[model samples]
Target: MNSRDDFTEATKIKLLALAANLCSRCRVMTVGPTHSGDQRNSIGVAAHICGAASGPGSKRYDPNQTTEQRKHYDNGIWLCYSCSKLIDNEETFHDANRLKTMKANHLAYASTLVGVALMAPFEVKNEIRAGIIEATLALCGSGAGKLDLTAVLEGYEDHLKSIDPNYEVEITTTNRKVRYDITAKEGFVPSISIIPSAETRSLLFEKFENLRLTGEDIVIPSEGIDFVGIDIFQELKKTNPKSVIILKSKKHKIESELFLESDKGIFSLGSFQSLLKGGKRVQDYSGRALNGLFQYNFIVDLENEKGTMEFGSTIASWIGKKLLDIKHLPKLLKAHKFLEQTSSYKFTVECEIGNTTLKIPKGIQNQPENVLYFFRRNIKALYLLNEISKTLPIKVSIISPVTTDNSIEIADFSLLLASKPQPERLEPGTLLFNSRLDELPTPLAIDLWCQRENLYLSVTEQYNRTSDLYGNLISFPRWNFGFENFTPVLYSSIDENDRNYIFVNIYSNENTTVAFGLENGNFELL
Candidate 1:
């Protein structure tokens, strides 16, 4: 492989004699009947079956082959100048059987190689060629190191030129981008770039100063990113608009990490690199591969012991839970924001407000199967806060409608207990009831401001039940009553005093207790 492995003198002599001093394809024997000078010295060229070099663009350069196997007598195929140029144009068509068939047919016509013994039937030859072409196409995709890239590209270019003669390709590989520019005669230029993940922002940093050179180490610095003129980590590069962010993904379970941490990770290197690097196409990754560029890799790094895998499993479960559960959380963004900050005791929420969204993070536990019900009994406290916002002296309860259609809301008890109003600055206890509305808010405003807190108001329209048969004793200045958001289940009747008479029966959700009846037709709240 280090040097050119040409054929033996006997093999070369036999090939030249078989050519009979003529071009192989046309079988012309000689350019002119009695030509002299340089033409006689070079009648035909002894082409190698397998190519001479090792690269993607090289012809028949299988990496697995030894030079001895490649430079054998069977490897030589004789061809004239014109046919040699045509055969070497694309490595895809320059396969073993294709060349064998051409040499056999050419000799069969002129009867050059082996009388008629060496040549096989043409149909049988095409059948074998078809099989080779099929296998080559299949292997070209996943065969890893196999197949010639230049040959494939040359064939592709020939097809493109058939449609447009001026079709041209330009490829540029840099640290920041790998651009492929295709120019067509039809006034169109399509371009694409492949930004390698190995050069992306990553924890694994490379230091040439620390490059530990061993005795056997071959330094090929020219093949790296430094060859390109552009330097990375520039402010302008970060500001440039990007649509794709390629990241490396590794196969989990076998390895210690979730993704095989290659220098190729193209996203989320540092905090500043992600500042203006905004796009919807942030999450796509390469195919599954083990180590280098294919087969298997990991996404997260694991730091635990053998089969335990505690850290990796914990990270995986957390990711899975977030992916599946957070999507189902109530659609309220505020609820999601609040839950994102919470670290302990996950809630099994049952929201009463219609289609509310709440995002909850997975954290601490409630042991013994670890389940906690969302305490919705306090949600009515939010409505109470709403009343506090209007400065209406009201005690509010949720109207659990019996028939779904009767969903109208009315003030349950707008009874002003304090005679002297304080609308300018309501009771100091009202400080807890701040925001009147939120998308999906918790209703624990009873911490500071509620009738239960400071007790600035205590007013009920029921009859004063202190006296035995005082019929109806208490009433508001004026009243128009309805049976909606009101709490206690009560029966009412018009008394002789024309005061509102009410007898309480039952209490429901968020309204577990009934308020006191008016004492002596006098209301004072402080």
Candidate 2:
């Protein structure tokens, strides 16, 4: 085991700096308010993608590892505090389904941060620009999908170091200011000059300028070789006030190649005609109104919002025709209660399972109540079985509801056949009661049950309960529920002649299981 003492102070500082940069980038990526609804403080923490517990085993910290072996940037990702803590605990971090969700969240946050950084003022002083660039480079590295000003600074530093044996460099920066210092050999008069590269000068003037600076203060020394300090400072201030001057003649080679490698396309358009006539059509013609008839070709009658009935149709005629063919449509039959209540409709559904009831609002017509019903039923049944598994001598597993289509079932329970306790797994089972299988009961119920009994309940996935058009129902066991797995439960409904759907699923380790199917709603234990 590598102890913390093995990490030098310099290495620790670098790690912390990298962490800070990553955290800032994550915050910028998740631009909207978090679950807490606060926008100002949204930065996430930089977590070791390989888990912090890896220590010396970590690719980032392995001293003996070659640079090429540790080069991939995907090894790290930004995570919120809650997710980070889960990773640090090493409990159960890498679930394929859960990982997909987390990766999407991370990508969204990263993209937002990159955009904000690109638009942010560069802080014209050479030192500040260098510091910012360094920080960005540390977070994203050279292959970052966006522009990195830090790589440019690194090339410049490498060039300067080659020119003098005793050269020293320092960088300072704030939101408003930046400065760079370069010192030549000791015992010799230090050669100090502003960064002389044209690219560097342009970036400073174009991106940094007044956007980042607060005051128009600049200084230059006179009587030096080439451009004197006073003369350079005065000229820079007039042309680009607030610019900071630094040593110029150092062998700092700002590589144009590095500057051009940003993911953000930087090529100029030249002119509109050049772009339009050169390649494929530069504009979209689809969905364009030809003669401005009805606003656009895709326009619908305003009075018939659902577009189920043609414009200028009587409500009575629409209802009469809809009711005549109700048997052919299962979704319409399910929604008959709302359809009969009032012609002016408010999309909503209310369902009851024993004493436990739920009310879902409008706009979720795509999600069918039948699906939710099965989810809630399965969840309740699983909790009940979990309670029984603790005190009972026989191990039990329950299949619960997996889909709104009534084709899948999921179950949860633990069995101990011999003296030793067996690991929990999901299998097909009969439905004890008619209810939704995907929905789990309240957390309080599970906690109370666990404290009272030594039983562990693991509910399986929601599965298809009904056969398709054929009499045979498909049994896909791997789709069974397990802890930490994230699966989507889909439901379908129709409103106002338009069909809608809803997809939902819970993410939990202890209260999940795979979905299965059985004959006549009964399972044969395997």
Candidate 3:
């Protein structure tokens, strides 16, 4: 009864190509060259949107589906191994309808490569052109040799002319040396010249024995650009502000800078020159930066592989009316010598290994008096770190010190734990418990502080000063809370009782206030 219906080989191939060999969910490239550099490696899986079997217990099972329909191309979505298993286990979140939407979104993103960058500058377009040249060079193997250009021109002529009407190809030879040049009439297409290696020339000579290299230019009547190279990174030069460019080149190396042109002016996203220095190719990379706001610095030196990423930022917030709730408010307000600026906070984050450094914009103001609100605003940095840890070993360090300055130091302590923690199990009735902390293998010997009036929470991984790497990259566990930040409105005075209690008002469909008393480093529901 549980007989599985599987996709055809053709369908599987189409699924991978349509998604551009990227997982629909995480958008990580699934196909790449293996370590041997000769064979290809594919981590892609043609996942079933609906259950493959007609069994009642099968996830997202549709009993009405026929065997052919169950195995049809439309029923499949390409995903990585981890994402495929994740969707199956989390059936509710990854329903068939949601998976279909994800498939459509991925296809749409892939289509943008051709649709958007069609008008990019000719010189910039040649980056893609260079990839094809490299691929063709590989076809001929190693060594400098002559290659026939007739078939290659005939195949791509029509497509090239689509981008520029004057597109033409010319192949000539002088003294046994071949010169292959692609040119356009005037501004239509810029002249392109690339000397094929000896091996490429040999293979081309064999492929087209009748073809001869002459001293005069041999022009081919073709007008087009090679769109085949757009799939190199599945992205184009003029990407949207929120777009992320992962280094998934067939060559696995970047030799130029990535930039963006906007109405304001041209701005540099970052450079990839250092990524390919020392003859190393980027083997694996994952992160999200270049989001139109921050300056990016990425270094993917796999050979040396030893470095640290440090990100520092200053935080400032206006001291609002809530200051009246503090115990020393009356005295502080009377002696308010520093009326210009209310508060300033500073902190730094250090990681052992990262592809890039993420900058947090300085002087964030008018923030809600919620401890979690700060984390929410900078969650992207955490996500970037998490993604990098998937392919590289990393350790996190957070440092914030309290000095005898007028500004209040919100950062008094740091929590060092795994970047990726186990599913946090909440102790019963704990209103505010560090869910991820309970799964620690050993008891953490660190100071813990919690204040209600001026909320501050600093959570970081444990700092053991050891070489051992901790944490596996996994999806953060869902929190049982609403999007609106929760704020503690009322608190029992510490002078009144040994056990201090606070009531937090959480916003949701209906406003609800929950009471909690501090106990054993956790806030228990009172």
Candidate 4:
């Protein structure tokens, strides 16, 4: 069925002119010049305000709308590729009303800009230029203010690493400032630099949060110590009357350093190894004995608004809490540990007779969800077959990629099972045939996506009838496939009346390619 009510070419051009070729949400110029004099580069989409198709995945899809209404210019809005996907992905937040309002507001703003350009006099050119400069500066500063510097740096580092796996990016905090140290492969340097435009600085800043200083005055507490003893504080003060001594303790290792405060910022003096512990015990300080084991808990700097702690002394935990801190670090630490720990569950049949289960040393537990589902469906078939004839011996085998290093992952597993089966040699990328006449045709070939996305992964090029669909013909079950360190690549185009379409090329082990199309966020046979 031709259910899509795509906008006409005229309607798309009208939308472009109406929005001044600017994305309604981002205000980015979507149409620009190309190297070819006769051609222009357009990254704009005449996005449907109410989805062209009626379905749950369709954003703001209206069932009552007629084909004419659905395809009309009034039902469309201009947007950039990223903004279009964002609105569809977050449809609840960007509802029909909200999208309409955004479009209306953008049109109004564009009209005002046009009016100003037309009416502004030459006498006020300087004033207008100054105003624009001031506005630009204000926008940049405000955009940067709303960003988390650390996150920006981390995202930038991730991007750099993705472009070149050999690239190494590290975020370091020292001298009261956070900086990024990116190292490419030996004898090579990356040409790309993270220079953000005025409009994009906000986004880039957010993504590269790991690059910037947190401006957090974090203090790693001395395990059980409370307040700094007045005697020890005075002793350290007497040694360096103009500087504060900071002892950074981590994993029972402490480094004593002197920090001199100045108008510009705090300066770190050379470290003094064993300056406090040299020839002295904890009880020799003429203060309460320190007994607990010390470990690093948080980051701190001498540039803290409050005065730095004295060396050979302890700062109260309360004082540390009052200082600036990055509270999410501990949560991030916990999350890292959570990801490291893996677990899984297995399903088995417990009949009045003996329990039927696989006897592999490595049980089905701890396998991927998709693998588990495949085993469950296989078990169901086996259970039914066993009901018919309990005397028949059933043999099951899981085939996986044969690697010389025995490092095949569980996700690569494929099932092979039969009752009273004849032994046959199974080769990689070869079809297995069913010897029994009663058995249905098994799926000889299968192609799985590492990561599934909307409007992608069409197994076949064309299906003549509804029953001819691969899903209906094949007995094989669907599993969401995944792999470690793999990222799916997507291709998109603004073709056919500026309609945005995302395409996926599905490749099987046989080297056959099948293409799929996405229209209005729904998959379509192409």
Candidate 5:
């Protein structure tokens, strides 16, 4: 049946961020403010501009309306808890015409403030540009603000040693400034100089006035802490950054192909020379338009002045967002809301189950037996995540030891089967069957992302029309094996999206009915 009551991932995110997650009716959140960062601070609900249901509560549900007209961005409003609740008290108050007017007016007010955000002073714009870089680093799932300079440097040095112990990269930090001392012979000195204070950073910029260096000479303008990445043996083609390997901190291991993921306005080796260069006036922004600001920055800012009228740390928040302070990172629906810790790379998530909320930590979900439990508890969130996954892939694997040894990682599936667990493979009531094959479908082991030719795993779902509890016909029961590092590489939309699959029922026995696809391998097809 056709329905107009659904919101796409993109539309929902737009309504929340643009509304600054504020309530529309009262212009005040009765439960709490957006500052607290708690999902509990979720007093602002994205109400349908027209009613979404045809039942008792719906005031303007149109059964004949087309999908586009019903779910359009204009068909939504951000309202606070009190207003959202009261609108239904008197059905006529929230009539379609009245609600539409409120949305239009609220957005117009938000637009004026964004005009200033876009045309912020030169100093402030620089801060925003810097924020983009810092945000990318934070995407590595680590506490990036208070960086471990020594650890980052050492990781780079170790990578260099692997190239050749004789090849050297030395790192030293003094007075909050960091310098990479790469002792090269025969006059070709590799240098990575991190300038701290504005005076020195400017002085260094002056030196680059007429000089342009190769990608080897990366002059990263200091945002704070030194960034040396998976730099060794990377594609020196320089134009396209493949992946980076930064050294790990003595205490924390930094692992991810973060900088490699290609996306729009996401990653760039942006120049900071604009700050150093003279003669550029803050253009005439007298028009004072929000759309102009949005188009200019290519970023969505959901801040409003009303929310700031009642704040003690607005200055601090501004500084952090402007500068690349870890504390005041950009809050978008795209980013993960993991738990905080004093010092750790991974983050825990707080999710409610039934009436009780539980903290789902990283280490806990990675366990084989606990995988089902995690999926069962967070089914709704995971479903939303899967929907959102169309835009951004959700990487749950840990790139640790099980994947470090490349030779072992690419081994045939049959060879690695002995090391895997062989217990109650199927849930108690799971249906099982066995069918003989003409030939053993070559015991192949592919990466998590391999060029495969299948979708909708051919087993349980095809027969019973029932995917596992998580709705995933194929999944990695455990992420810390050869399969952890694999990702399905799909070149075109037409190609199959499945990867890292292993056929399980073929290997199941009466005693060990592993119908759950419990057996783990790099192949995604089960």
Candidate 6:
């Protein structure tokens, strides 16, 4: 019941942290400073669940204050800096209707956070407090937070699906055009348009070039003219000279047509519609008409089967490529790491549609040229995976299926012991070979590099981005480490590739549990 002005800075910070943590746990605020980096000197701002101008008796109003007192976190909802700024600066947020919507959102988030905190044990509650502090500071520009890739991809996919399903999709290449016949299904034939932000026309064209054709065929007409007997004989004379007497009759028509006899056959309007329905036609063209104005014509009726087959093949090839391109999406989860080594680690993993590679500590690797290529490919594949996960009914796993044959052996801890202890009786502190973050002892320092790498791989492969920043310097709490009575929490990885070197308190106690290898330099722990 204390008024906002009566609260101490320390108390305010604690309350803000609690609010942010509650919001984060409820999946309201996914990405922010509090959830991404170390927790210290971080501050979270409070937002009103109801408008600041709401009546004093309202739930959002700070009841402990006088009628003129401004309601803040003491009786309002807490928000990250970005949200606060968005509310204050963006005209949309200030709209009465929007304010009402925001109030509902804030109240829902607050109610959920409170529920989660109440159900959690004291230790977990402390962690939640730390998380909130980190979240708060992150808002105040002191920490970072996790990327809500799951929510992002989900929203994107939902939007894509919500569009009218009957729109016909098409891709045009230098040699051919591929079409999707959506009208045949009795749905609105959507005008062909690609999501420009996600893909480019050139990429789609290139994919079309590699498609494979299947099923029946159709042909294109020449000069927009309907083929007659005379035209057929004239075409025959140039392509097949063996005929002694080329007879022409109005009733006689060529059964097949080829590009070699380009002038003989013409397409009818009905045939044009048929070709489009079959997804074979690209675009309408014209050559000659009654008043010197060329009449629009569709390609149909070939003289040679080979020419018809080639045309169909080209269209089919383009279709195949388009399907593949649509299926794969690139992923871009930010990861960070810090190294003192002149030599770097090059991580490589192949995804469903392409490969993913990264060079940690960029210049630390022997082959720096390959690093960029690796990063680019993986980034692309990750995006594809993220996109595909939205539309397709597929479950992407977090664990990499493509693991080194010696990964199990390499992960074994007994091998690291000088006097091989029994596996069953192995105590904590048993070092697994170059321990990844997961295998460390309970009190060990969490390896940020491993966490980032693993999270990236998991997001790309498993469609799961849930991660634990426990036992790491970044996730360490101020109280547990005997720090300056400040709150602590995990922040986001640095950049997109280096998932290590998280921003942490410079004042926290140094612990060696988490260590990194530096070529020509000693290993150090925070």
- lDDT at position 351, candidate 3: 24
Candidate 1 lDDT, 1-526, residue by residue in tens: 3666777788877776666545656664433333445443454777777775676656776567688866775666777777777777866866867777777766665564454443236866776556554443333334423544333444433433444355464434344343333344456553433232454313122321212211111222221212122222121123222312222222112111111111332111111000011122221111221111111111211122111101100111112222113221222222323333434322221111125431111121232211111111111222222323233233222232121111111112332222223323222222111122121122422321221322222223443211100111112232222111122322444776533543432222232222223233232111
Model 2 segments more than 4 A misplaced: 1-46, 51-80, 88-526
- Whichever of 1 and 6 has more lDDT, that candidate is 1
Error of 1 at 74 (Å): 1.1
Per-residue lDDT of model 6, residues 372-405, tens digit only: 3333333333332333333334434322222222
lDDT for 371 (candidate 6):
38
Stronger candidate by TM-score (4 vs 6): 4
TM-score of 5: 0.21
**TM-score of model 4 relative to the true fold?**
0.25
lDDT of every predicted structure (CA atoms): 0.34, 0.33, 0.41, 0.41, 0.37, 0.30
User: Candidate 5, residues 127-205: lDDT per residue as tens digits?
Assistant: 7556544443342224423565554555444545565444466756666444444444445545544433555466446
Q: After superposing candidate 4 on the true structure, give the runs of residues whose Cα lies further than 4 Å from its correct spot.
A: 55-57, 115-526
Cα lDDT tens digits for candidate 4, 264-366: 3433322322211111111001111111001111222224422111112222221223111323223323322332242333322111112432111112233
Off by over 4 Å in 3: 32-40, 64-69, 114-327, 332-526
Question: Each prediction's TM-score against the native?
Answer: 0.20, 0.16, 0.25, 0.25, 0.21, 0.20
Model 3 per-residue lDDT at 264: 34
Query: How well does candidate 6 match the true structure in TM-score terms?
Result: 0.20
- Winner on TM-score between 2 and 5 is 5
After the best TM-score superposition of candidate 1, give how far the Cα of residue 298 lies from its true spot, in angstroms. 91
Question: What local lDDT score does residue 31 receive in model 2, on the 0 to 100 scale?
Answer: 27
The runs of at least 3 residues in candidate 6 whose Cα sits more than 4 Å from the true structure, single-residue gaps closed, are 1-43, 47-75, 91-103, 110-526
Q: For residues 1-526, write the lDDT of model 3, one tens digit per residue.
A: 5379999899999999998777999988789899989998988999889889865657888888899999999999999999988888899988989998999999999887654533335766676566545543432233224454333433333433444455454434455343434443555533333233454555434422322211112222111111232221111111112222221112123333333222333334343322222223222222222231222223333455433222222222211212123233232232222221324322211222347543221122222234322422333222332233333333332212222211111111101112212323333333442332223222221111132222222233332111111122222211222122123223334566523443332122222222221112211111
RMSD of each: 29.4, 31.1, 26.9, 31.0, 30.0, 31.8
